[model samples]
Target: FYIHYIASTLKILHEEGYIYRDLKALRASCAQPVYFSPFVKASNVLLVEGRPVLIDFGMCKNISKTGRTYSVCGTYHAMAPEVRALSGLDHDTRAATTSGYGYPVDFWGLGILLVELLTGKPPFGYRNGDIGDLFELSRGSPSTIHWAAGFEPSRDLRDLVESLLQPDPSKRLADWNATLNHPYFAGITDDMLPPEWDSDLGTEL
Candidate 1:
């Protein structure tokens, strides 16, 4: 249920030409799978009426017109490899070059969140809770899941996670439309989605 909600949220954001750089457990608010949240880490998520909702927008980025951004921001463990790669360069270098990222970064973060939801830990080992270690791990290689005893996930689900976590953003799932069409969401259709899920918020940002 949370997967569907998150996918829908991503769909909405994509239609609006924005990228939600932050995706993590604390960034979601849910009551039996009604999810919403905004920007950054755990502290930004809040509960409303027993449902998790994203409450912070401080780090949200509007990329509708340009379809990309180069800001090296977002939590370490949840960042896409390209986003983490930017950390080694100075801001001036980033601004002077065409190197940056786009919506795929959010999908990478969502992949991390999905792993955490299933296994109670990020796909990459937490690296003793060190931010630098986490970034290094994220930038190194794609993660392989090792489920706890008797907690194995379905093959389709695992495939979905792996696809989203692809190190190459270009090769990652191509936005929410492609995501919702995956086998993991086999039976879900546009008719079942909420009205807001289809509304185009436009490229005003």
Candidate 2:
């Protein structure tokens, strides 16, 4: 149900030209995300009639034609590498990136959310809580990402997670239309699919 709920939420967010702020749900061991309650902690999520609803849009950003925006916010582990790297930099430096972080950060967060929900741990491991180390791991090749033991997820799930976790937002899955068709979401019920909406990102970057 979380898979369907989150997928649908992503669709809604995409249609609205908004992206989810980095979630801080998952923590060490039971950072409380393993149960699929949302480890960035469930403070941002709520259950209504057994349906998981995402809440807290305080950090949401409006999408531009280019999908790039400035200012840094998001939590460690869940933060996209680009966002993490750019955070704390002066405005001039962030502007120099040619493209500041955008909708892709949400996809990255989705990947983190999924991994935590299914694997009981955020990708790259979370034993140390060192933002620097997490940032370094985020910048590394996605192939180096360590999937947890005892959790042999399906190939499609792994593929989708890796794709969403792409360090480069350009390569990550942010398109509302494209994400709905991922094999991982193949089993999502029709009611769980969010209504379609126009996007400046198009099908992909």
Candidate 3:
């Protein structure tokens, strides 16, 4: 259910030429943030009708027309390597030094979500909310994903997470079609997805 819900959301956003910069767990009722410090994380997720639904669109941006955006914004732990790179800049310098990012950042967040869901924590454990450590850990090699003792995920699941978590956005699983075709989703079918899911996104894997 979580997988389908996330896929459906991404499909819609991609079709509309947008990227859900903040893909962490969100409360269905909290679509908009009232305070200035807005960030997405597992703590924000809320269960609606027993299904996971993302909310808090405060950080979302329309990338359809531009294809990319430079402003870096998102939770420290869930951010992709490219977005994390922006941490090196101060607020004033970010505008000049940031190279911008595309939709693949959300895929990296998805990989973090998968790891958290399976092992009860993100692949690279958070360190006191330090952006430097988070950035370094996120950029670590794929072999850095540590599985908890007694919890061995299947090879397909591991592969999917690794692919999505690729440090380089160019190599990450940024397409919905390619992502859905991964072996981890082998048994999923159209009937099991939400009506909003775009079946034409790509041929089934």
Question: TM-score per candidate, in order?
Answer: 0.72, 0.73, 0.75
Off by over 4 Å in 1: 31-52, 89-98, 127-140, 188-205
Where does model 3 exceed 4 Å of error? 26-43, 89-98, 129-133, 137-140, 193-205
Compared to the true structure, candidate 1 yields what TM-score?
Answer: 0.72
Q: What is the C-alpha local distance difference test score of each model? A: 0.65, 0.62, 0.66
Go through the candidates in order and give the C-alpha RMSD of each one to the true structure. 8.4, 10.0, 9.5
Q: Tell how far residue 31 is off in model 2, in angstroms.
A: 18
User: What ranges in model 2 sit over 4 Å off?
Assistant: 24-46, 88-98, 130-133, 137-140, 190-205
Please tell me which model should have the higher TM-score, number 1 or number 2. 2
Position 46, candidate 1: lDDT: 31
Candidate 3 per-residue lDDT over residues 7-52, each given as its tens digit: 7677788789888886654422222221212233424643333355
Clashing pairs in 1: 29-52, 29-53, 30-52, 36-54, 37-54, 38-54
* Model 3 residue pairs with clashes: 17-64, 25-45, 26-44, 26-45
Q: Write the per-residue lDDT of candidate 2 for residues 55-171, one digit (tens) a residue.
A: 566787777575678777776567777776666432222212335777777777878877766665677665355344465544455765667776687999888888888776777
Candidate 2 collision pairs: 24-40, 25-39, 25-40, 25-41, 26-39, 26-40, 27-31, 33-39
Global fold similarity of model 2 (TM-score): 0.73
Q: How many clashes show up per model?
A: 6, 8, 4
